[model samples]
Target: MNLENAQVQMRKGILEYCILHIISRGEVYASTMLEELTAAKIMVVEGTLYPLLTRLKNSGLLDYKWVESSSGPPRKYYILTESGRQFLSQLQTTWEELQFSVNEIVAKESKGE
Candidate 1:
């Protein structure tokens, strides 16, 4: 695959976790969340993010409130629900395990070469 395609594939694996971690930090508007993710070099569009947010909300992992915005009518700010915090904790554990496994494999491959 081409470099761009490969990068997109890589991001698909972790985007959900990344989004949860970001939203877990505090209540955040969609625009701000997009900015933060983009600044972190994760390419995401509203189309992608909104659907994921809706899914998370539907799953009872997130709660949101509408806040007045200077630029717009009102914007929805999302924060983690109690269940979301619990889920994030579990996700963190899983992420750590995956990171350790990947690091070990990479280190082994490097040492073998």
Candidate 2:
């Protein structure tokens, strides 16, 4: 098995949660989100991000507004809906639980348990 493949799968698994968390902070544009994700070493691209955004919107977890821009075409800014907020809250709890469980297991392994 390829370790690189596993690493990619791990990143993909949490991409949605990370994106939702970022949007929860405030309204954001795709480029801004992409930049932040890159800075965080998430290794995402526009092609991957756009489809995920559409899926989230279709699921009623997100909404977007098109704002006119003087530089060029209008930009779609994403904002979390009430349902999105509630969903994210649930994800937050799940993440914390998973984090604790993973840390405990890793700690045991490190001790040669």
Most accurate candidate by lDDT:
2
Q: Tell me how many clashing residue pairs each candidate has.
A: 0, 0
Any residue pairs clashing in model 1, and if so which?
A: none
By summed lDDT, the worst window of 10 consecutive residues in model 2 runs over 104-113
Q: The CA-based lDDT of model 2 is what?
A: 0.96
**TM-score versus the correct structure, for each prediction:** 0.91, 0.95
**What TM value does model 1 have?**
0.91
Question: What's the residue-level lDDT of 35 in candidate 1?
Answer: 95
Residue-level lDDT of model 2, residues 47-98, one tens digit each, is: 9999999999999999999999999999999999999999999999999999
**Cα lDDT of model 1 by residue, 16-90, tens digit:** 899999998898988898999999999999999999999999999998999887986998999999999999999
